[model samples]
Target: MNIVFPTLRNGLFGAILALSPMLAAQAKTPADQLIVGMSMVNLFSIDPANAPGLDASGINANLYDTLVKRDNGNPERHVPQLAESWTVSEDGKQITFKLRSDVKFHSGNPLTAEDVAWSLYRVMKLNFGLATTWKAYGYNLDNIQASIRATDAHTLVIDLPQPTDPLLVIDSLAISPSAVVVDRKQALQHEKNGDLGAAWLVTNEAGSGPFTLSKWSANDSLVMTRFDGYWAGPAKMKRVLVRHMTESQSLRLMLERGDLDLAYGMAAPDIKAIERSDALQVQALQRGTMYYVAMSMKQPEFAKQQVREAVRNLIDYQGIDQQVMPHYGTLNQQPMQLGLAARLPDPGYTMDVAKAKALLAEAGYPNGFNTTIRILSEPPFIDIAARMQATLAEGGIKATIVTGTGNQVYGAMRARNFEMIVARGAERYPHPYFSLRTFVYNPDNSDAAGLPNFQGWRASFFNQQLNELIDRAGVERDADQRLKLYHQAQTLYDKQVGPIMMISQMTDTAVSAADVKGFTGDDAEATRYLGVYKQR
Candidate 1:
């Protein structure tokens, strides 16, 4: 709901806009604290290897540091935090990191190589630790596992099976302090009810980050305070609070009314009116935030490629983009470019009414059948589902929408719950793999926090090719050949409607005017908030 109102201006550019001329004119005052607002949608976890959602992105980024955080368009490059520097072998398979011996985890112990090795060990074994990329590299277990080793107290060497390129495969891995977890075996002993290590990371801060974890309640709230001995100066804010409610209407009503400093997890249009005045600013953390619907390829309804194509054509993309979310997004024309299918073409699902009818006829479904689509009880998605139902109706398909909350929705999805779903997550940074293969390529019943391969379409062959693509993407020195393989895989994905993907371009945060300064985003979605500094 963007509005245009002319403001009195003498210059062509309109007198350098200022929300508050008096405030801008006044001398800058450095405050002791910078309070950040957390309305909802913040997941609690400081482990970069496993931090998920808006809260985690905000909290963990400040609390932990990754080995390599990207600057901008540049590939995932290294910047000092725990490791002051590192060197890659000529073949690119091995990476030798020189640690910053001065740094210590919040637990009060110095960072060490043994911890680094254990941390890698933790990531290599997904269910046991905070590392979340298990689905991304689950099949290629050989890439990790025993691949990492600590040669000395301060030096760590990683041996890749081949010349694994840093640009593609492993971005900067956020090093975990050995002082905190000590050993992987012992760490599992701390798990509550023997679920996984994520439980420990939720309320505990074993990281070498700027802030220390104090308390946490899932979907409710999390708290953190500065680590006094943090190698970096103490954080400005005395404490940080986070919550995880994803209600837009409530968030917009409460936050804009001044009850909160910031709010998220909801896509309320209420801010449009406020932004027209000087009372608010929207800080979107843009990277590659993608959202989409996936169909069960194994289902009889969607077994035919033509049926998938026809259903795609029936999507009211223009109607949705133009009507409901005029400000939120642009039409995503390809799947690979967004969501878990990064680099694949969207086909815009082309809004061809006749072609859709013809394809349906060719598939012997000229009089589209009735079907139900699954979705989260979350907003925006509910709206999206309804919109899809309406548009599919126009294509002779009767689409019923079924919605549920949390585990209920996830459980159904896991069991091949519905013919379709409007699930969220993916389009992460550092590489396309982070955005894609983590789900679509290896999605199956074995996965927990991964894509629901419930449709039971296990194209092991496609995934195998995907693995070759991953290795080549990282290690191949020839840019041309690397692109060739990338394109080859991308082509196969594009030609098939395996997943109905829609991408959300970086809408992560709004870079504030309050000197929340530093490079805010990159090819990978990570924003190194520690690098951000207030202007002196």
Candidate 2:
């Protein structure tokens, strides 16, 4: 799907006028409203516990507030939100948070420690995919209430169920979608069949953030009105209107016509064409998600280390990054994200047909092996897979590309039923421990274990040593020791020829009107619009 946008000197403005009549009528968006256009195909759920998509996180960021938030530039530091102050036990097992008394939920219920504790308990009780985060920290449905509880209306306490760094738990609280505090009384009032409002929250919200959900229609549009009683402060914009638009051309046209204040997921050509426009500003936000080529270990041919390494060499990383990933991602070979103290330099793996051929021969496949590459039928992913198919042919590997939706592509991987896959995922924040855990740690390899949360398990790549190193790194309080453990784990994964080979780190580009101010993209995709405003 190659799209060409007219150059600025070549009737670009005229093209905008001819394309969208609906948008042309409203050339200028409302001064007190922020209009955004993006694809909402993945935003089916907004329930904090079950909503795992980036779109839902962005929506929830405006609709809800967490106890704390990770500092944008510095992942190691966390600033308070609903929590006024918090302290960790010297033994590093207990944490206590003091809630702000003046805060009130959108339901007019006072936000308290009870609400905070109950929100967490609700996550464990529901046991959705998001529950994996707390489960990894040893919190379970049976033990969550006892472990995380409210001592008083103002004080909430958390007791660690196992030996791990208390900071990791704190970091999870700062970034996890399920960490947002919910109004327990309000949620229970709508509970059905003892679901704890799970069904209602799928489309509705029970939050105290800067905005309240005024209306939402799946795959249509969503409107968020500013909450006047917001404890922080009222948002500058009285309303936030997000229109669901999948066509990149439409997004570009709307943006060019001054109908859209901000647009996301536009084609690269559209973004590049408008990069130099005086009316627009483009920002590339680095996300923690990684694009990787994963081979299931369950596949007989890929179970061999030599075959795995051969497949790795057959990947055209340089070509993919230079040609296909202009606005989608940056070249990243390591499992961990960039700009972290614990991360190591990329091992510098490149496509080498001769090396791949030799490895395949050594693995008893001199005539090459036939395999399928499952990927989402979308930009960047399909492009990467196509590039891989061409390069793999050079290495004597006959691979066919199979395209499908997110559910088909990822669900197969999670079920450990695919030969290969090119997908981006698992981690959403730039934390060393979480990155390594998402990509490398698989405690149990049994199919009955059913831990799809870990991409490592999905690919059936389980290394006892790598798992131990990551587990140790998660618990080691000494910064130097933890860094060493992370380095060692990366080296071991390389030596083991791990099934998941990372090709790039994702970068989401947002093009907005130049007049839009205070619009910084959150690293975790939980972008809050509290301070956003039009300069005019």
Candidate 3:
């Protein structure tokens, strides 16, 4: 898209008038605004309760306030936001939060403990995809009200429904998109059919964050205006405008011309070309999402552990990491993300065609059987799929590649209808227990269970031992014991040849102008612009 700005100084324009057309079109952004470009194809909703995409999480982070936020440097520690202080009971079944009394929503209504309680209640009540986070914690709509309630105007109390770690719940509060507090009174005013304003909140926000949602249109553009009365002080930029852009080349050109302050999802080559430029800066932000090739165990071929091991051996992990996953991700063979203390060293599985062929023969597939591989029609995913197709063929597996949009590709996996898929997903935070629970724990394996939230269930892979270990790790009070449980779960998954074979952990590259400062990305994708400002 073409972005035109007011003419610069007459002399400056005249000096560059004789230059190339590209140079002539250069435009500097306003000092008090931040112009961002990114693919908004997955950003259809801003409703915290239902919006599970990373793009939506970034937008909502600026428009809403959670009870607490994770420390950027340390993922395990949480810093207070709306909740100034909190305490856990000795029994480890209750948590009390003291909210800030001076906070107010954009609607001018006071933000009380009631708003906090209602926000969580609304999530459980809606039962959207994001509700799975709470559900996994043993909370249900029937008991959520009594379990989590407002003790007073500024005090909120949460009683655990099970024996899970209180810290994990706190971590969820800091990172879960649905944990953002909403304006209870204003939301109820627009509530229809007991949705708790779910429809209105799809585009409109009733939050007390530094920035207020000014305007938003699906697959187009969104604008956020600074809230002058914001409790945490107004954002540095008076306005943040996000243009829905899908073309990486267009993002690159706009960023080089100074017309775009920041860009996300740019191709690796473009980033490399501009890396040496003095006017631009690129930051490779590590995300907690994992990229993997998952096979549904419901398929007769994948159900056999020998066949699964053959497929695992067929993967070209080293080659893919070297060729396809440059800026997209880092080599991570484990289901858990890198940099976590509980994570074990990679098992060093390589492409062993001989071993794969032998295993396939033992599984009764002397000549590899035909299969279909589903993937998103986007970079890194399609590239990885292509490489996998070649490697699998080397082991005698004839695989056909099927490409589609994010919904089509992931939807099939979520429905348990796809034989194989290459995708990135689920846990968006760096924690051992949550990671294992996301990729290994499957409470129920029946298709009728309809638990698409768990990647394990989606792949039809279930092991009672793995589930018990993960469950024990979640509530294990002793740190060493928890680590031991986590290690045991990983070992068991490896032994069982889990269907979801992790290839890499995601790393989102954000290219921006050199002047854009304080734009630190969150591992959970909840990036806030409260401290971001242009140096100019």
Candidate 4:
């Protein structure tokens, strides 16, 4: 990688200058490198088995390879990756993947079916991350090992313990980290104290992707270098340096100064201004990302369906869309996102303080109640929470807001330790099953289940009616029959009151220099960097 040294013209001032804000504004990424500025507090972890948030997952996507990959060129379609081809049993209980012979890991180890099987086993054995995703389909810690196995060097088979639609398993594995194949030999060689190299892999990568983790400093920066042995051929940019920048102004300045190639986290207003610059380009694709509020049914007040409905109806949807969400998102309330099957339009529930107050009174809280709403201390989320607070106050419900980093905010939600949380949910994979599992269905809500697969557990919300619908949807082979079951679940959720669906986000804007090529506007960061070349 190329490094540049700044010339100093003064004494103590020169030292200060080198370390000042100007350092961020003036520092230039090498021409052969791609530098990204983001507002994330810090990466949680890069290990696919443990990383919970999107930023970490995005980084991991570049370092790892999945057996199957989504076709970025065509949304919601699959393509072969580490696995060149596959076959499924007529009963749909078994899937066999044929591993590619030529793929090699960054550790220089040859790819094999053993690595694919071991990697998936590790995800379940570790009992975190995608483990919950697999659990929803009946794979458990005790049975996962037996269900997935390598019969030979080039062939791996996954036998579902229960009969279900094979598409469910295929889609789940395709987009989730559960499908990422690690270099088993390398990982086992570094294993320490029975940790299975978990500690070592946090900062290191042993996969077959185009880039390998070179360096990562918490709350500072993460640097990745292209793998010369990459199976698809070398990346155009030799290095990728992502700096932690929480401010949009700094990112704009750095880009204007030609210090950075792309800025990943820009507010809508900032993006508009940046678009006017002839040297820069901006693109936005409305993603299936949802921002909503969750109420803990554990609270006696929230347990009442009437109170939940009151809270849902108290928000001024049109006002927020016009004021807070302009250019950033659009209002969408369907349990499933639009353009997907069985999607219902917004129920047209409008703001009515009187109706909300009456409902709160009916729920045994005539004087309203006081509660806390947890939200990340960042743009749009905090601001949106404030708007909700105002509306709730109008209905005699007093809401105190709590703000923290994504980890602090989401951690509490995952642990089911909050009264309410202002959160965002997205269909990481383009499938109705993802949305159904994420928001409506939770097979096991206990902490022991590591229930990250579904938001139902977080809200302490469970309906046997909704659960049964999801279960039937899982096993139904007919597309029309499956969609009917999902529609039933949505109808049930509407009547019962689940999460307060707020807005579906539009493009997460990425501004880049004019010379950048092949950057895609996508919800999954994994697809964005693949095959993206710099046109320098």
Computed on alpha carbons, the lDDT of every model, listed in order, comes to 0.53, 0.87, 0.87, 0.75
Could you report the Cα RMSD, in angstroms, for every candidate shown?
8.8, 4.3, 6.2, 5.9
Please give the RMSD of candidate 3 to the true structure: 6.2
Model 4 Cα displacement at 119 (Å)?
1.0
Q: Residue 364 deviation, candidate 4, in Å? A: 1.9
lDDT of model 3 at residue 188?
89
- TM-score: model 2 vs. ground truth: 0.92
Query: Which digits, one per residue and each the tens of the lDDT, describe model 3 over residues 1-536?
Result: 11111221122233233223543365788889888888676676799887887888999999999999887646568899999999999999999999999999999999999899999999988887678788888999899999999999999999999998898899999988899999999888999998889999998999999999999987567999999898888789999989766667777877888878999988889889999999999999999999999999999999999999999999999999998899999999998989898999999999899999999999999999999898765578878988988899999988888876556677788789999999988687888888988898888898787777789999999999889889888888888988898888888898999999999999999999999999999878878899999997
**Residue-wise C-alpha lDDT for candidate 2, range 1-536, written one tens digit per residue:** 22111211113344344334555688798899998987675677899988877889899999999999887646678999999999999998899999899999999999999999999999888877678788899988889999999999999999999998888888899988899999999999999999999999999999999999999987568999999999988999999989876667778888887989998877788898999999999999999989899999999899999999999898888889899998999999999998888889999998888999999999999989888888755567767888888888898888888876555667788788999888888587898899998888888999987778788999998989898899888888788998899999999999999999999998999999999999999999888899999998
Supply the TM-score for candidate 3: 0.92
lDDT of 4 by residue, 1-536 (tens): 11111211123233223222644555455667787877556366777787756677678778888888667623446789888888889878899999889999988889999888888888877776567777777787788778899999999999998867777677666777657888999998999988777888887878888899898886567888999888888887888888776666667776777777888766667787878888899877566667787888888999998899899778888887778775567787765666776676678878998888899999999999999888765557766888989998899888888876666778788777889887776455556767777787777666676676578877777788788888888788787988888888888888888854545544467888887788776556454465676666
- The residue pairs found clashing in candidate 2 are none
For residue 430, give model 4's deviation from the true position in Å: 2.0
**How much lDDT does candidate 4 score?**
0.75
